[model samples]
Target: MTRDDPRHDVAAVVAALVAEASDGQITAAGALAEPDSLALLGLTSLGQVRLIQAVERRFGIAVEPDDDLVALDTVESLARYLRERGVA
Candidate 1:
């Protein structure tokens, strides 16, 4: 996929948020490119908060506090969310 790919942007955002949450332990784009779990990437509950906020801001959508975060726990899942939620 190109750099502008939705998944790529999702991965980039996920990587940045996870890295910030995990204290710089997992910022590699290559790793995030195929990452299967945000938990594995060190996304804590607090990180998920930042991620949600960032997603809302970057995607220009309102992610409810009661939304299913698990659906956003992976880059692919989030990409699907963007597609299905009519945000992409």
Candidate 2:
């Protein structure tokens, strides 16, 4: 992961968000790496809101209420979405 790679940065950010949301219970060791790991994050509705807010603050991106939240269902997808949105 380099400063020149937005996807890597996005992945790092997503990992951080997942870590924060999980209170470090989840790590970047494939805990949230795959779509199947989404449930392991144990995000509630409020946790989701907090994660969104953290992402917006950390990456300077706005996540509208109508945005397809499913894109964040997995770490890779969230990283891709952030990269597409220029969040790197």
Candidate 3:
């Protein structure tokens, strides 16, 4: 992760948003890169919605209700997703 890498910044923001949405249940130091991190972070239905909303607002992107959330399963993937959407 470097300042020159958009993914680095995107990943950090995503992690921060997830942490906030989880009420600290999910943290940057809690191995947010694992594929199962999303499964564990979103312990509740409301949590999932909140996480999506937070990220959407921050990046001005929308995660349609029909979108496959697996793309956001990990920080890296979410960062890539954001980059693909022209976030950087």
- Cα error, candidate 2, residue 19 (Å): 0.5
RMSD of 2: 2.9
Candidate 1: tens digits of C-alpha lDDT, residues 16-61: 6556655666564633665577777566777777777777777788
Model 3 over residues 19-82: C-alpha lDDT tens digits?
A: 7777887786463566665766554667667878998998898987686677767777877788
Q: Output the number of the lDDT-best candidate.
A: 3
Winner on lDDT (1 vs 3)? 3
Worst window of 10 by summed lDDT in candidate 1: 26-35
> Residue by residue across 1-88, what tens digits does model 2's lDDT show?
6777754566776877877876776676554455664665666666667777888898888988798877767777777778889865
In model 2, the Cα lDDT at residue 67 comes to: 81
lDDT (CA) for every model shown? 0.65, 0.72, 0.74
Better of 1 and 2 by lDDT: 2
- Evaluate model 3: give its lDDT: 0.74
- Model 2 lowest lDDT segment of ten: 28-37
Decoy 1 TM-score against native: 0.65
